[model samples]
Target: MQKLQFEALRRIGLTLAVAQELIHLLEQHPGCIPVRVTEVHRETVRLDDGTQDLPARRMPSLARGLADQDDAVAVGDWGLARCDAHGDWWLTHCLQPFSALVRRDGDGLRHIVVSNVDTALLVMGLDLDFSLRRIERFLALVQASGVRPVVVLSKPDLCADMPRALAQLQARLPADVPHVVLDGRNAAAAEVLAPWLAPAQTLVLLGSSGAGKSTLANTLMGHAVQETGATREGDGRGRHTTTSRSLHRLPGGACLIDTPGVRTLRPDASEASLAASFNDVARLSLQCRFRDCQHRGEPGCAVREGVDGDRLNNFHKLQREMRRDTLTALERRQQLSEWKARGRAGRANLRAKRGE
Candidate 1:
């Protein structure tokens, strides 16, 4: 009976690793039941117990324990819930996600977009929504989370010069990361994206508004599961038709999560992740004359010679942002003071050199 119950859970994206972890948790908590968090509200969360969806509230102790964490509970997270005497389910504990898509907000807080994602289908519209720099940012985020990323070039029909656009993307993107071009509204998307839609695998669609993430989800599911919207004629930017992140079961047995368009995507990555994402620049930096070459007009700078100017600039920008985010309040103030001191000293040295 337990095996049959687990088989049903497998249809909803329960893997061997997660099942093992749940078994351990069940051993610890005798009466608690394993549930997948489908949706999270302000005070309650909706969980799927493989058979049905139920509203569950977080225990006060559990909420307090995760108060300092980046997110209390994200979509696709598994948790252990227990029912009270009144028959209302209360989420007791949220299991740590094996993988998570996280991004840093402007306020320096980490925001988890989704959890336990196996593959990230980075949906970028081939129209006005296409940008290689933004895709690189997404790659960094996905790579840092230990999730596989496949670039999905959506709305290929809307592109004026499809060949040129694809050529530019291939030139900038990493060769190992697979990219596919297809119309999301067509039924053929399922066939085009079949390799990653295998049973028990979980995929998430991430892109800006009007990128056709929802449309692709519907096509893959063979029905209108998510609502679709039109993009602005002037800017080609789509409205936020999908407000919340939610998971859907595909006909192929894989789970798909659709998220709303993100306006600002600051990558929550480490230095190693940044280096791996921009491997080309990182490799070239080793050939520079100076070991710590900034690649800013420095003599014998191989990064500047080998890498594209714009891509190199974007790498430097992300590096700076990551450094700033990791700094403490006191460290930031001290760094500002040091910069002021250096500026004053540089001005004095100029006066001395000019005999002023």
Candidate 2:
């Protein structure tokens, strides 16, 4: 392993331990080089091999192993790149990520948003785009990925009452979670997010369109690296200025992955994350009368008595949603299995009939 290679990779969010591991893994396969994926596109991906960015595509061997060929790459992923006999580069293999942030499609299929992210900057504009419910949804998603959530209330300069808005939003979040209010376009905004932008840390910005995610990315990078668009005057909803997820290095010595504005985010989170995101409600539930108290009409329902009525309702609603999703997924799997079994039986019966 060359010292320069390791140092350059480290500056781009590769840990020393992971670099050594990649080196060892590559040693077994001669002529293969280590590279980190910086941007993922429909047909090709851009990788940084600790020296320069290289555009490559997945090899046929690599594509065959993926359930969806399009899922062959994502931002913040580490992969092995090898030049074919034709001198063209191909991503040979992707390293298993230590962590990944995923969300569900309308049909409930999971999709990777970003990988190897340590922190999630959950941005919400303090204008018409602000909603505690939306924040909770984002929190559940981030918590599920085991990523630290930092609530960033953007465009506070536009808010009529920044302090009041900040306090109200903070009241709804977990007390331990860190948050900051700032104007995403201001240069001072970068300083407010400095703690999470330390060397080698990879942070992702998540928020609705026009929520200032792209602006924040540009401000943090200390340049106009990301395209910024104006939000609708009526609703304050911004258009999708960022069409793709790309990883950019920040002046603060960290990697920042900015995603396109997501209008809706349905979390396919675990029960633990659900409870953690709604810690207050979860705590009240523990004090309820029965171990399985629904808290709707149960006697001695601490959740009903102590928690805010709307928040409690939202919590219950999310619980029901997760349960429904789990059941739906199971039923879908079972239906597929039954269909396969019936087809097999039908073929078997046809063979028996022919024999008769």
Candidate 3:
């Protein structure tokens, strides 16, 4: 009985410590729940509890308020806020993240997909969703987010020859990284991912629909909390079963955030993510004849020579795409800045004309 008491106390203390750390990260926010946000109504949010309804005002997230509201906080973050005297909750702030999976918004602002993520399970089903280009895009996003990316090949049951598909994926991935192929509905699959399932840790699933992201989240939860759907026969794309981002506590004590599978993921690449994701390309670029060589039909393009022609082409293609995305984002920001400047100037002119 004494040992049991000690263990209970220890657990409580550990939980408190984790909470405190998050609070500090949130700049000592007063009233936020630890759970993720699913559906945000005008005044409330539907959490995973299925019974507990959270007041939207009480959930402080990065998406809450900022100059760039388009890049709002995502589902998998640890939030900070407090309940008022009336038992109403109001979100005040959110904990800063160690690493975040971000993508640009339609307005060209950066948006957080998942925050404080330790592991990003880059999921792709064995069916039509499996594409090297898509995987590379995810890799860039993972690299940029400063998180470890583990390729998870889901829906093994759907694939007639798992080994062959796995082999193809393996050949495409960077040699240094690891990949896991598993049936998303199986508990044994979670067991394979146990290394990352540490207590108080957070992991997020990043994959297209039909890759079994919702199923994997269910497996980790030891029950079904999310909806699952079948893939389209024409293209093998799964319907977006999870319309919103939601967090679930795993049976193993790890936290898992399952999000809606985006049809297109536009990445906001950093130099580090670029280097890490495309190490081969970066390494070869150093040997180029021209310092500013774009590697496009340029003579003495080291990147083209060092890597396989196909691999180099793909690398250049992604790099070009990232550059284009970045430029577009920058241009959007510039336009906003100019508009704001014009507003300020207009106000100043009005004040000057009104001067006595």
lDDT of 2 by residue, 1-356 (tens): 22327667877799866776787777776678888899888789888886688989887787777645446467998878888788788998888787889887766667888999999999999889988888888898899888999999998767898778877777788998999988998898888988898999999999999999998898888888788889999989899899999988876679999999887777878788899999988888889889999889889999888877877777777776676566676787886799999999999999999995
Give the per-residue lDDT digits (tens) of candidate 3, residues 1-356: 00112222222112454456654544443333443444454455543222244655534443355335544445544444456788766555544555778887554467678776778888888878877778888888888878888898887777888778877777667887789888888889888898888775677888888888998888888888999998999999999898877666676667777888865676888667777887877888899999998887889998877766666676666666566566755686886799999999999999999992
Q: Could you say which candidate leads in lDDT?
A: 1
Model 1 ranges with Cα > 4 A deviation: 1-4, 334-356
* Poorest 10 consecutive residues by lDDT, candidate 1: 1-10
- Candidate 1 has an lDDT of 0.89
Quote each prediction's TM-score: 0.92, 0.88, 0.77
The better candidate by TM-score, 1 or 2, is 1
Error of 3 at 257 (Å): 0.1
Clashing pairs in 1: none
Model 2 ranges off by over 4 Å: 1-4, 68-71, 328-356
Candidate with the larger TM-score of 2 and 3? 2
Count clashing residue pairs in model 2: 0
Question: Which of candidates 1 and 3 is the stronger one according to TM-score?
Answer: 1
Worst-scoring 10-residue span by lDDT in model 2: 1-10
Q: Candidate 1, after superposition: displacement of residue 283 in Å?
A: 1.4
Q: What ranges in model 3 sit over 4 Å off?
A: 1-71, 306-311, 325-356
